[model samples]
Target: MEYNLEVINLTKNYQDFHLQQINIKLPKGKIIGLIGENGSGKTTTIKSILNLMTYDKGNIKIFGKDSRNLTKQEREKIGVVLDDSFFSPILNVNDINKLMKDFYSNWNEKFYYETIKKFKIPDNKPLKEFSSGMKMKIKVLCAIAHEPKLLILDEPTNGLDPIFRYEIVELFNNFVSNGENSILMTTHITSDLEHLADEVIFINDGNIILDVLKDKIDSEYGIVELLENNFNNIKKEDYLKCLKYKNEWYILVNPKYEFQKKYPKLKVRKPNLEELMLLLVKGE
Candidate 1:
């Protein structure tokens, strides 16, 4: 399958932190969830892909062309929404519309206006007057109005209520329906990824720990709740991670290994992405 974006052995080092040997691919028309804890290098990886930060090694390709080689015209096909607001605090929505119109060659005034109205963002209200959720909506609107082929979003759901978060997830679903658009969303909210992500890349401490299809994860990893007494019998090497809550111990095991047969009394169940991520990151 052709990829919209690919990162090959990417590495970036900072004074105190480093993004080491990161490899990721964003397949065309798919929404990839980049799951990681804070300071896990998600933003650093995104910046390296966009060439916003210099990497010590490796290559990033967008549309099969090296990202570093892409000219302004080529780069325009990608849209980005970071954690912070890029628009000036003093600028109102009207000012932003005019500013972006001059910035992007393919900027669509009609779409921008329609989105602002659909999101209920007041055209005359200054950015500083808008709530965090409203500002995030504006950022999303600006990114989509230009009709970019690939979008890179960093914590787009931050500060959003549950209702609006669902709305944003639906918006992303609609965006990728065009069949030419792809999204790489880095977010801590794993619940948002349950229904939306086709693929998930787990990052921890600047390194990718797991990269797998969402469906495969659901089918493979089982959460086995064993009695405290039985925990000592379970082989620690066989499980990916384990946690103990009071008298019961919850273990994440590969279902292919026949964990149920070995521990018949253990309550084996499927785990969601969030639980799996917590286990991977916290070693529990």
Candidate 2:
């Protein structure tokens, strides 16, 4: 099977933090969610893939070719949306369209206009005058209008309202339905990934701690609730993590053994991605 993006033993070192040996593969036509806490090296890993940051080790391949050796045509097939704005603050939507047209050989003016209209952005307004949400939409429009095969997004949903976020998520879903494109988006919003991501990659302290299919997570990890008093009898080692509330305790467990049968009174239930991530990151 072909892959849209692949990272092999990728490592980057900073003065105070190190992004340890990282390996990830993004299959073609799938939306892979890269979830991590702040300063977890998500951005660093993305920069390494884009060749925007210098890394000490590992190989990055895009479209089955080494990223380092990518020609201009190969580079044009990837669209990137980082946390920082790429367009000039003084430039209007119209100006941005014209500028990007010069950069991407496959830039589709018709698609650009349609995206702008769909997002309800005014072509004449200066980008600085637009709200954060509008600015993000403009970035999205610019990135997608070029008809890139892969999109690398860093916190693309950060400033949007809930309604817009949902709309954007659906847009991404539709975008990948064609099975010729893919996206690798890094976000802290686990809820977004729960619905849209086929695969999930969790990064912590500059290292990948969990990488699995979302469906597997749903089938493997479960939440077990017990009375506060009974919590003391539940072994901590048996659970991935646990939490205590005022009157009850909730634990995340991988119930592959007969342990649940032994503790018949434990209330077992399913957990969403948010709960799983909280447990995994907390190590509680």
Candidate 3:
């Protein structure tokens, strides 16, 4: 299988934080959701992959080319939507369009206008005047207007209302329908990942804790509340993670069916992305 992006033993350090020995494999034609709390190195990993910052160790490859060595043309094949990066807020839709046209040889003018009109974004209004949701919509539009093969987004749906979020999700669905494009989006909004992501990578404190298919999460992974005595009956390797609240224990168990067959009495329920993150990140 071909991968769109690969990070091998990537590491970066700061006075208080360290992105330690991170490895990721993002396959083509899939949406991989990166989930973590603030200061968990999601943005740091994305920045390193884009070569926006230097890493102390490891390698990053995009579209089979070394990320640091990507040519201008190779770099153009990736679209990026950073939470805190964009054209000047004083620039309007038209100004951005004009700038992107000159910057990207593959910029699609027709698609740009079509997306703007479809989203009812004013072509003449400055980005500073737009609401947060509208501003995010514009950012997404700019990222995809060039029709890149890979889209990397950080918190793209952070402040959007449900309606706008739904529209943006639909647009993402359409973008990847061709089966050649892929997206790596990091968001605190796990509800979107619950529905859209093919797989999820959960990062906490600079380490990747969980990497699993969304389908398996829905079908085979589950959480069970067990008493201390019952919890002791299960082996550490049998479950992914465990948390204790009061006298009850919440354990994240994979292959829920097998677990159920073994216990036959405990109730195992499927976990949403947020619950899974809490269990692994905060649990023992």
Residue pairs in steric clash, candidate 2? none
lDDT of each: 0.87, 0.86, 0.91
Model 1: pairs clashing at backbone N, Cα or C within 3 Å: none
lDDT of 2: 0.86
Error of 2 at 114 (Å): 1.2
**Could you say which candidate leads in lDDT?**
3
lDDT of 2 by residue, 131-195 (tens): 99899988877778888899999988989989889999998898899998999999887888888
Lowest lDDT 10-residue stretch of candidate 2:
255-264
**Residue 200 local lDDT, model 2:** 94
- The worst-scoring run of ten residues by lDDT in candidate 3 lies at 171-180
Give lDDT tens digits, candidate 3, residues 1-284.
88889989999999999999888888888899999999999999999998899999999999998999999998899999999988899999999999999999999999999889999999998999999989999899988998899999999998899998888888888888888888999999999988789999999999988888999899999999999999999889778889998999999998899888887888999899988999988888
Give the higher-lDDT candidate: 1 or 2. 1
Better of 2 and 3 by lDDT: 3
Of models 2 and 3, which has the larger TM-score? Answer: 2
- Candidate 1 Cα outliers beyond 4 Å, as residue runs: none
Candidate 1 residue lDDT tens string, 105-145: 99999998988888888988789999999999988888888
